[model samples]
Target: MSEKAMTDIRNDPAAATRHDIALSIDKVRGVLEALRFGSITLTVHDARVVQIDVTEKTRLHA
Candidate 1:
């Protein structure tokens, strides 16, 4: 398995907040096709995606 992205989920603050869900699926086909290498980072708040970041992967052989 490989580390695809970094996820940071935080609680939401609302006066009438009842419930919140957290989940997201990114269309990596484009990214993979474009760069052919990178990483992904996803941030969510109150079950909503807030941020996303992509970088290069680092692999080492033993």
Candidate 2:
């Protein structure tokens, strides 16, 4: 998601007012949870979370 999208989600007080919006937010949360062990990058503008990026890593054993 772009910074604007993230910001909109974060800043929107009516997000939970709509079932679809709430579900969408929940889906995003799920994705973040799944990527918990991965590298996460948060871009902040004015001390607010604006963007998130996740990078997963795998280890190979001989």
Best by lDDT: 2
**Lowest-lDDT window of 10 residues in candidate 1?**
1-10
Residue 5 lDDT in candidate 2: 68
Per-candidate count of clashing residue pairs (backbone under 3 Å): 3, 0
Measured against the true structure, the TM-scores of the candidates, in listed sequence, are 0.37, 0.42
lDDT of 1 at 33: 62
lDDT of 2 at 32: 81
Give each model's whole-structure lDDT: 0.48, 0.63
Q: Which ranges in model 2 have alpha carbons more than 4 Å from their true place?
A: 1-29
Top model by TM-score, which number?
2
lDDT (0-100) at residue 60 of candidate 2?
Answer: 64
Write candidate 1's Cα lDDT for 1-62 as tens digits. Answer: 12322221123354113222222343444455655556776676866656667787657679
